[model samples]
Target: MGNISGAIVMTNLIQVGIDIGGTKMLTIAYQHSKIQARSQISTGKDFTAADAQTEIERFIHTLAAPPDGIGIAIPGLVDRAGVVIACDVLPNLVGWQPAIAFSSICPVKVVNDAQAALMKVVSELKPQTVAAVVMVGTGIGAAIYANGMVLSGANGWAGELGSIPIEGKTLDAQASGAAILAQLGIDANQSNALVGANDITALQSIERAGTSLGMGLAILINLLNPETIVLAGGTLQWRGYLAAAMQSTQRYSLPDLWASCRLEVSQHGGDLVGLGAASIAI
Candidate 1:
């Protein structure tokens, strides 16, 4: 596969991509040619930074030998050098550095979860189109890509659209999965009771959730001008729910910016971080 820069060839190496989110951990094993397979595990509250690292090492023991490069996608701030500054997804990694720790084990590259997702979009958009990614999972995130180059602002927090501060609260606080659950009168601990609990009720959940997403997308469209914005998350699986908000928000943004842009739910799968992590591992 090509490098994040579009033409840089990677070394002949087998790579592993690991995504550590607040609710789950996903791993993907891949060669430059294609993904071998993917795996996922629940990230109960007990899963921590060190535990996540141990999980990766054990996974490596089964695939490639030690000393192989690894890429990590975590929630929170990612510096230009791929160092995680802060993250709430894994409490064990709070202020715990990856370069100093994981690098000691093997050459490790770190990335913000959203940027990692965008990398997969960039890889998938190869040869012609540009891409933008909006991931609305437990929280919301977005990143822009043009010619395989990612646009990260000066503070290294570029893809963060969740904290735009809407009506005395951020979008994440008001409309995240947790927030959606809160609106449904569910407890914080029971937030994900619906991921696989799909039914007619889940369909209603989708439309209700889409209303919040539509409001958020309005802000996104006005700020970032791109050819296409792809939405990725379990929330988008209810296709009608996602499409509703996307179209609803269209009436609120600038004509020029909104005219050329298209809102789409990414079929690229949630393994994006794992896949893109492999792409940039070397």
Candidate 2:
């Protein structure tokens, strides 16, 4: 396996990270920031919590030895106790507790995927910096990091921006990859259709989705006034989405607030969720 030394500081040995997404799952074993093993698999539409556990277990079997700890990042609402509270992207994951299911494997921690993404960048932030990571993937989700700490709030549900109401429908219903794909009469796995789309209807649908996402960003800027907002996720691959989002964010946000906040795309090109989860395991 490929190794990247000193990318992340670790105090433990043989840590494992599993990132479960709507269409795929990625698992990696790390030995002090160096990869020891890795695997990627598709989690089809009907994939359930049990299926996830089975996949995790199977991947662990490939490692040279048992891991000291495991962390799972789910694209949904996870409680403080590392239990899946709710997950709209992977509906069957709701209520799934990986810690309990994998007690025999090692110590396990569960985290919201977007929050886990935030963790990947947390160590690099300047103290007292207000930042947020908004992930626009199968569905939209965000996590806030303020004043040198992640703003998890009372149930680890503070950043459910996707659920925010907008014109009677949730933001996710209007701006997520799934939403855009649905409008184009395609399936979640067919997101490639959005790339280089030249048709007027397809382009318009993408613009609307991007505008909706921008509105959501405006909400974060107007209320939190964060200094930096990092945008991440698979949907960002769409050609015109970012442009539309930038335009709408400027249009909807207060001029002073917008001027102070700098928007960034993640520079960590690897499996960020997996890396973040692995960091938590350490």
Candidate 3:
């Protein structure tokens, strides 16, 4: 499999990428295909868009000089104008217009986090075929690439997978990292709460979340019959969670579709989102 970690140098222009995730925020500066600077900070569940804006401004100033362009990857329904319309995980971001705010500094582009992730790896995907990138972090979001382009519905909200209803509940409420923590009755502010957990309750919580995630994937497979489905995000660190999800996906997905699709784990880790955002800026 092609690795997504190394630099894909294509230009001499300087660009900045900002990834605003449910639990953390990452920022990077790239020039000539190499990262010149990087920064990361924890963002608790209570973190709001206002807090994110402050952090973004601070990170930009820390760069040696202004970048030629900036790209931001964020979770939620972002409109064509880069305004976040709705975000279940970070509801305060609704109506937040980061792109417009930063446009004065440089050309800015804002997109859904999963869409940015798919863009980061579009080169590796089979041409003119359906491919999906699913990120299972604090929330579950996906992006669909078909016919050699990312699919954007009329509202620019084609892949809001996390909010889709299943079994009378939103997928995010049942399958996401936040959902897993909630199932275990753990505090959302506590990081790594599931690591090394071996109790029956913890195991059951993991299984429940994993099953939900698998069901969501099965739905995608049955609907799109994608040639590739790449899974990424911090939650995959839990081996048990991934195992349960795979088993359930295999069980729930149509036999033909399951066999046709190739499931892959992303080689790029925490930096993948930021890199994709940088590419968007380029």
Candidate 4:
């Protein structure tokens, strides 16, 4: 749709992307880099590691009952190869190595979900933006860039903006999509039903949430000094009222950094995670 119109396109081979979040598990059928089919499954607090695995297989099964490869976005650390360990919200998967068993399902690739969100934005957006994709869905996470190199930190833990301690608590504790929803005493189902997003109400709701988002971002700007911050994920997409609060909070961040950087909502396609996973596999 922009300058790089022909860079990535769908072909005939079957490709799938699986996103496992605290609230849901999503899978899509893609050829080349375009999504052709998609489905979402409920992943409540009761979801277990085995259940997550099952849903993954089922998502694949629905797409021709078999696929060439499946790429997964798990909320944990993945080694260079694609083994998943260390999960936050997905306690049922705590310490288990997925590659050992999951490879049998298909040629699989796995990565931290936050990294996938970052991949979506970086692969498609303009490089000059110096963007940071902050995902508040399931849990809080971010991916940053300077020129073209995505910040990987000392280990693979660099993008975990959620763990940064603030106000005697981490961002996850005070402003996560789930936590914020809980704070407002709104059940996710109710929010989704009312607003078609994990966070709802609009006009009034967007303003307050945007303030919380800005507060969380102030810490990021102070640390990384990115040029633009892109807000992604289901909750942020669903709510349309938080922009004002975000702007108000931005006023207090490092003046020089804020003055230079741009803060805007994300416009990347949904297939970004899939393409990123494919890029990882390739």
lDDT preference between candidates 2 and 4, better one: 2
lDDT on C-alpha atoms for all candidate structures = 0.69, 0.83, 0.82, 0.66
TM-score of 3: 0.91
Which segments of model 2 are wrong by more than 4 Å? 1-8, 188-191, 194-197
Candidate 2 has its poorest 10 consecutive residues by lDDT at 1-10
lDDT of 2 by residue, 1-282 (tens): 112222346664998988898778989888855777889988856889998988888988888888899989988888778888888778888889889998997999999988888887766677668889998888889988877677888777888899999889899999998899888897643545545446677778888999999999999999999999988887876878888999999899999999999998888654778888988886
Score every model by TM-score: 0.83, 0.92, 0.91, 0.80
Give the candidate number with the greatest lDDT: 2
Q: Residue 204 of model 3: what lDDT?
A: 79
Better of 1 and 4 by lDDT: 1
Give the Å error, residue 26, model 4: 0.7
Q: Can you rank all candidates by lDDT, best first?
A: 2, 3, 1, 4
Pairs of colliding residues, candidate 4: 10-31, 206-241, 206-242, 207-241, 210-242, 210-246, 211-245
> Which residue pairs clash within candidate 2?
none
Where is model 4 poorest over a 10-residue stretch in terms of lDDT? 1-10
Poorly placed runs, candidate 4 (over 4 Å): 1-12, 126-129, 191-209, 237-241, 268-275, 278-281
**lDDT tens per residue, model 1, 85-179:** 76654556666556666766677888878887777666556635556777777677777776556677777678777777766777776656656
Between prediction 3 and prediction 4, the one with superior lDDT is: 3
User: Cα lDDT of model 1 overall?
Assistant: 0.69
Q: Can you give the lDDT of residue 264 in candidate 3?
A: 80
